[model samples]
Target: MSAVLELTGFVLTLGGWVVIGATLKNSYWKVSTVHGSVITSSSLYENLWHSCAEDSIGISNCRAFDTLLALPAYIQACRALMITSLILGMCGTLLTLLGLKCTQLGSNSENAKSKIAMLGGMVFILAGLSSMVAISWYAERITAQFFDSFYGGTKYELGYALYLGWAGSLLSILGGIFLTCSACKEKHRDYKYAATRQGKDARIYIKQSETVTSAKDYV
Candidate 1:
């Protein structure tokens, strides 16, 4: 139950980061573009902002159309990532809860290395999730405004959007790394568990062999 809640939150977080990353990528693209640079200038922003609201905002307009096609895809990707991140987050939450709830917690052969891995993985998952939520929300708003600017007069707004997307990328990258780390933690934990179990079983077998050899000699 708690796992689901935590996971849901994590998913949103990762989703936000992914959105931020995508937005940043878009921003970088624009910055490099000939038109993007021109449109982003302060003077241009003042003249162009709110220009589209006064007209049909042209479906055929090349620049406008570019955003329409590209932004939707970006949004879609963000959504998909959001879903996946959340689900993983849920798994992490469940793992933590189960680890905590087990009666014979320490006796279950959870080795230190494995435990560390699991813990780290959970942390990363959380970080990733948080990033996703923050970035994604901003992305959605930016996309909407970009599309709504039909009057072709939104230089400042568009430029600002580009800048936000640019700045947000840092968060996106950091969050992504953290999320990935959390997964690694879980995987390492599994490896440790298996190794510990194997060691214990080996010790048992060795003792049994020794006991059998002694009995044969005594006979």
Candidate 2:
């Protein structure tokens, strides 16, 4: 690809990753903490009153307030956003790879810078995956505590989407680890097409060699 196109692809993909990561951080740490605290504090009063202990039942300000209430709304929103970001990232990665190929990027290619660009995308994917654990923990808590409370105080059952999101998050974590290693891999070899020219000592030669490139080149 031309310099202009290459630069554009890198900027878009990198920026998208940043946006997704920022969203997750804000939702999990900032929003969840403040809101979660309030919910927990309120629930203590209710728990004290509703439990088997008779003395604490009629105490003032005994209304229970479980943090799980604040937890679900935010968790659901975060899950939606995360799923969207994953799809978006996949698209951006594919486009970036195409652009790199256009610029003749590959291990043996003259324009090897494409490899680095690919590695950059892989890193972004890894980042997304790493955050999944934090998100999942929070999400599961929200669903189990808050959602289940609605149906006669039974343990809540996660819906299909919730389960899918959980599964996807786990997969993303694994994928990120895989990609991180793949991106750092240097010296990868593969078969190269070769043809022999007729001569006195003509013989077919099969070239097997590795391509070494840095992650930065893809960008």
Local lDDT at 95 for model 1: 44
Give the alpha-carbon lDDT of every model. 0.44, 0.42
* 1-219: candidate 2 lDDT, tens digit per residue: 234444554554455455554444331221112232323321221110121111324333323335544544544455565656566566546535543534444454522444554455565455455445435664466456654535444232232333443444444444433333333332132112122223312422222111223334555
Q: Write the per-residue lDDT of candidate 1 for residues 1-219, one digit (tens) a residue.
A: 422333443444445445544543343222111234443222221111111212234232122333434454554455455445445544544444334323343335444333533453454445355435544554455556555647353322334544454344433334334434544555565778999999999999999999999999999
- The TM-score between candidate 1 and the true structure equals 0.38
Report each candidate's C-alpha RMSD, comma-separated, in the order given: 11.2, 16.2
Winning candidate number (lDDT): 1
